[model samples]
Every structure is written in C-alpha cells, then in structure tokens.
Target: MRLIVKIMLLFPVLLYSQSNFEKAEKLFSQEKYALAKPIFENVIKENPNHLKALEYLGDIEGMNKSWDSAMFYYGKLKQLNPKEANYYYKYGGCLGMKAKDCNKFKALGMISDIKSSFEKAIQLNPNHIEARWALIELYLQLPGIVGGSERKAQKYANELLKISPVDGYLAKGHIAEYFERYKDAEKNYTKAIAIGGSKTTYQKLADLYKNKMNQPQRAKLVLETYQDKTKS
Candidate 1:
C-alpha cells in the first residue's frame, strides 16, 4: 500500500535523527563542544525547530563569548517558545555582555531592551531567582541620570530574602561592600556563611577581607579555615 511505503521511508529518517541527537548530546555532556557543535548543526538543519539542538548551540556560543551568535539562537528560541522564562533570561544576559564592550552611548541605548528582557523573564516566572538578581545588579550599577536606584536594588534584595535567606544576606553584603561599608559587609557575609557555608560564601568573605578591606591576613585565615573544614 502507499501508506506502508511512506511509513517505511520515514522510519529511517526519524531513527537517524534520534541516533544522531543522542550522540551529540553525549558529546555535549562531556564538554566536547567543538565535536558536538557540528552534529547539532546538522540536526538543526534537518529539523530547523529542534529545541535542544538550538539550546546546545546557543550554550556553546555563549561559552565561546560569541554573544551575537548566542543571541541569534536564543532569539529564535524566544520566538519559538515565547513564554519560556529561561530563553528571555539568556537573551538578556547575552545583550548585557555585548553591551559591556560597546561605546557608552551604545551601551546606554541597550539598557531598556536589556531591562525589559529580564523583566519579562521575571514576569513570566515570579519565583525566578536569577532574574531578580540581574535586576538588583542592574539597578545598583546604572547611574541615577539613567535609572539606577539603591532603593530598587534593595527592593529586589528584600524579595530575595523572602525567597532565599542566604541570597538575601549576600545581596545586602554586596551593597555594603560596594559602598565601602566593610564592617556591615562582614556582618552580612558572616551570617551568610553561618546559614549556607558554601564555597561561594567563603570565597566572597575572603575576597572582601583581602581586596576591599586590605586585610590579607584575615583573608588567608578565612581560606585556611575553609580548606581545613573541607578536608575534615
């Protein structure tokens, strides 16, 4: 029958796609991006809307600091899946990174789009932590002549506190450190270490001691304490 012939012909193509995708996924997982990229490209060529393949390619480009390429893929993903928060987040992140190297006027022009993208991510998912963190940093760093506001930054920090206590303390500490309020930073970082005790918290406190406060001895002591704890 004609139907039987169509099924027979199509099965091989589907099988080939699946097998190739699996192999590409394995390479990607192993961090062999160069090897994986071409295969994923082929897969996307055959199936132009392949989500995972597109995401992998976007991630590879992001790792290589090819922001425009990453934005192209992520932009496609946003169009394909508009409600997906992470796609918007990645797109915004790519734009932010690209803006960093541009002329000040160009970077300023990019701010609205960057802010909207991250805001869209948060609007899509209210509990999105990374989007909130991005907003906090954006508000903190932008000059008041534009849109910067400590109040806006603190608002997100406060939201972070409600969602995650560790991040809350860390955010407050970051603001304090930015203002050269070393003792306040130490207080918040100390609380963060007590609650989380992760390497990130430890390193943050250590870096603060050494770089900001210029207390190398205290930094050394903190790192030494962390190493001893890890060994035990």
Candidate 2:
C-alpha cells in the first residue's frame, strides 16, 4: 500500500515533465528554438538525464553557432550514454567548429580530440554515414603534417560509395574541387548527377562550372536541364 501510494505521488510529476518535454519537442520541430530552449531547460531541470532534451538543446545551440554551449550539452550526453555514437559525433563537430575561430595553435592542439571523437563514433557504428562524411571533410581540410591525406579522404569516400552512391560521388567531386582539379571534379559531379539527379547534385555541378571553371554557359545549360527534368 505504501509503494502504491508512492507511485501515485510520482505519476503526476512524471506526467507533467513528459507533457513539458512534448511541448518543447513540438516547438523544436517547428524551429522555434528560442521558445523551445526554455521548455527543454525546464525538462532537464526536472529530469537531469533527459536524453532527448539534452540532444535537442545541443542541436539548437549548434544551429545558433554557440559551439561551446553545444559542446557542453553534447559532452554531458556522451558521459551519460557513452555508447551513443551520435553524441560523440556531435561533440566532435562542435569541437571542430570551435577550433575554427580560435588561434591556429589551439586548433592544432584540439586535432587529436576532434579526430578521436569522430573516429570513436565510427568505431561504435560501422555503418554511420554522417560520421564517415565528417572524417572525410576533416582529412580534406587538415594539413598533411597534421594527419591530412587525400588518400584517407578518398577511402571514406569509397566507403560512402558502398553505403550511398550519390554521397560518394559528391565527396569525390568535393575533394577534386578543393584541389583545383576542375576537370576531375566535373567528371565526378557529372557522375553524381547521372546517378542521383537531385536539385543539390545539379546545383553542385552548376556551381563548379559557374564559380570555379568560369563557364557561365555551361552553368546555365545545367540548370536548364535540371528544370526540364523536373518538369517532366
């Protein structure tokens, strides 16, 4: 009888917390992050280990470019659930963004942590697509002395081929573009469009032609083709 009474006493509080979280989640889905953040804060206050609330708050901070704030939430999330791949990934991404605005030496110091976090995420989930993409970008952007390697980037890009063909081609195209290999980028982007043909794929190729290759006419033609394809 005492246990039943205790359960009854706790149920209302739990219900209120759940309802508050639900309301916050609805606001978050609508992208009213400012309004949602306070409710999520309240949810976390009531239940400190509320995973979704923490994740949502982290995401909101990330979107607002508040990297340190995002990192704090993601860091707590990883500690709370060490097995969750996405939490580590989010923490690494926030670290990467934070490094960008700080001094280069400080950024260099963070390299290992950032790399390890994303790598750990991949280790925990072999088929994680976003983690692989993050690693690919990291390799492409880092200097060779700091462990950057086009080969490594391509390796992940190849893995993406097996998991997602369009992403694979897009990543290859991105690497080529970064290196100023315009023709190679064009080929990869063309392949991506041939296979996927979405607006994003089309826009990528058009951007390459217009911005990098100085081929305005080609860019125009690509967009026209995209329009025709979509119309049909």
* lDDT of residue 128 for candidate 1: 82
Q: State the lDDT of candidate 2 residue by residue for 1-232, as single tens digits.
A: 9999999999999999999999999999998999999999999999999999999999999999999999999999998999999998999999999999999999999999998998999889888889889999999999999999999999999998998899999999999999999999999999999999999999999999999999999999999999999899
Using Cα atoms with residue i matched to residue i, what is each candidate's TM-score against the true structure? Answer: 0.94, 0.96
Q: What lDDT tens digits, residue by residue, belong to model 1 across residues 79-149?
A: 99999999999999999989887999999999999999999998998888998889888888899999998
Report model 1's TM-score to 2 decimal places. Answer: 0.94
lDDT of 2 at 160: 88
Clashing pairs in 1: none
- Whole-model lDDT, model 2: 0.95
**What TM-score does model 2 achieve against the real structure?**
0.96
Who wins the lDDT comparison? 2
**Which prediction has the highest TM-score against the true structure?**
2
